[model samples]
Target: MGRTLGVIAATIAAVTFLTGSQATAQQATSSTLTMQGYGWKLTDIVGVYAISPSETYTITFETAAMKARYAPYYTEALKQIRDAGIHIEIGGVEPVDINQCGPKNHIQVTERYRPVGTPGWSKGVPCPWQPQGLGRGGLVIYNSEYWDGSWYISKANLHNTIVHEVLHAMGLNHPNVDLDGDGTVEPYECVATSYGNKPIMCSPSGGYHTSNMGKLVHFDVSGLKALLANARAQGIS
Candidate 1:
């Protein structure tokens, strides 16, 4: 896990300033940015999505055609999240299950392709009253259509996606940066990195294509750190 984090750190350290098109999207602190439609919000993390800092949140995978094949990707993503200082753990599997999500403390990983606007999406289990409130647990659904495409998405990309969506299940949203000043957020427009951009939460187009991308970037770690800090404030830890 440390090695995975080290790779991301090195990648961020090596990122050079943007030259032409991407120059407008300068690297900004995650603490100040908000999702475009979410009203001048800071980073996408919310207090309700936080898990008990004192507990290891268990994660399970539902039986699906892709579960065995893609389980490792989700597993690696969880390790990377844990490495980022968010407490989490893997749990049991339910065979031939279909949306019996429960317990409100465990995460269920499943596969499905829901192309609403992006390739993947996640929702906290038991549902939260508002997008900003606390959520006890969640669901991570992989868009298999995006995964099986011919677009040459590397294992790094898969891992990045898993990490990104899992963070969403924990109540993180896309780190929006309206680089064009159109009063709208664009995908892959968050904090900049050497290759172009960073931030696993950068929407459909963020993160490096290199091995470094498989791990959480600096901003991602910061977001989780912020969540943990909030947990402390709420007396969850």
Candidate 2:
């Protein structure tokens, strides 16, 4: 597992895509709960303020409607992070500029409708796109189709996508593996528990379903703990 987590040291950026309801997906064979490799931010030219924020990143939504819909879901998922000793702030509705990294310790969430085939798309975390300043902020734009009923996804899947993208904004990447031993890693191919639970951070929306999708799975929390551990080692604690 240590060797697997080593990917966190070097990988520069990541992209999290939620698989559509019709997308073919497979789960890892393992039945027991496990934590796998997912890259995170260490240091970058824009300055790694993500792991070591001056204060803490405050989550802001693009509009009141977005906040009303997703903020509670975020609170549910962020509980794991806070309980693990990592902290982030939740702010109120505000206009977001996805084009540029905004204020320091800020997370701007917006909504944009992508192409029909695309599900939901979000960028890497720890401010991967920051080209300058201490702006440790990133953008997370959910696909409008999820709400417009154009894309038919379960409520669980929709909530899981929110957590997945939020984790990506915090520097976690897809812990994709060759689950089928086909010598090729595919999207949403991640380890799952015996009960059929996969990491919430899985590339194409792998996590709890039919019950509750607003909570972080053990595997996902393990990744957050790993990030904090790594940050502490880097003297960011």
Candidate 3:
């Protein structure tokens, strides 16, 4: 299992900043900043995969059809991620059997993704409430079982989901949560005004949002930047 020390340490560090010169520095840097006050435990190494130039990372899919559907968007999203200096190593896309759709299966998948000697499925299955892992090199298993029939899994939704999960893997918690001592995190009541009217990152239904341009966008620059900054602060590659 991924270690929890990073999260604890990050929390402590954030809390420390809340009371000292660090707080002043933070305030001076960006007023819009709101520290989420959470951290991730480093369970695996962060690296880039799939795309060439050895920069962009990829999400290995379970089938060619799945890749055909999601690759384009994944490629685009990855480019944005790379531009931010984060290198994601996407394993080659492959087909995961139907048997690998449940919690236990996901655990096994996590093991495959984790480096040798690192924590793996032996850590116990992940809680259903938390689809993403608590470690640095997190694994997001996308199975048709959870999304096949759901409208939330549309092409647009897939893009958003991948981006959102990638952010989670990078150690960014939900921005909707109030971590900067604010009373509460932003809430999404509907797709219309969700994600601060940005992209699908904070969408209401955990998917895509309707855009004025009639295009489906997954994340806004600000949200992406925030996530990147948090990942950097946590020493995530």
Number of clashing residue pairs in every model?
4, 2, 10
| Model 3 regions more than 4 Å off | 1-58, 63-65, 94-135, 143-155, 178-196, 203-237
Tens digit of per-residue lDDT, candidate 2, span 1-237? 011112422332333321111111112112221223542222222233224422477788878988888788887787777886666878988777554555666777777776222455434344543322122556676777778777787788877887776776665666777879999977768888788888877766678895667688877776766655544444455
- With candidate 3 superimposed using the best TM-score fit, by how many Å does residue 212's alpha carbon deviate from the native? 9.0
TM-score of the candidate numbered 2? 0.73
Worst 10 residues of 2 by lDDT: 20-29
| lDDT of the candidates, in the order given | 0.51, 0.58, 0.35
Give the per-residue lDDT digits (tens) of candidate 3, residues 33-103.
33332211111111111011223333455556655654554565566666755565445455443222232
> Compared with the true structure, what per-residue lDDT tens digits does model 1 show for residues 1-237?
011212322332333421112122222113333322321112222223334566667666776444565556556556666876767776677542324433555666776655232434422222232222334555566666656573355566666776665666665556657878888766555666566656766766455567666566666666666556655554555
* Residue 176 shift from truth in candidate 1, angstroms: 1.4
Q: Where in model 2 is the C-alpha error above 4 Å?
A: 1-50, 115-126, 129-135
User: Least lDDT summed over 10 consecutive residues: which range in candidate 1?
Assistant: 1-10
N/CA/C clash count, model 1:
4
- Which pairs of residues collide in candidate 2? 31-194, 125-169
**C-alpha TM-score for every candidate:** 0.67, 0.73, 0.43
For model 1, the stretches where C-alpha displacement exceeds 4 angstroms are 1-49, 64-67, 95-101, 115-126, 130-132, 147-155
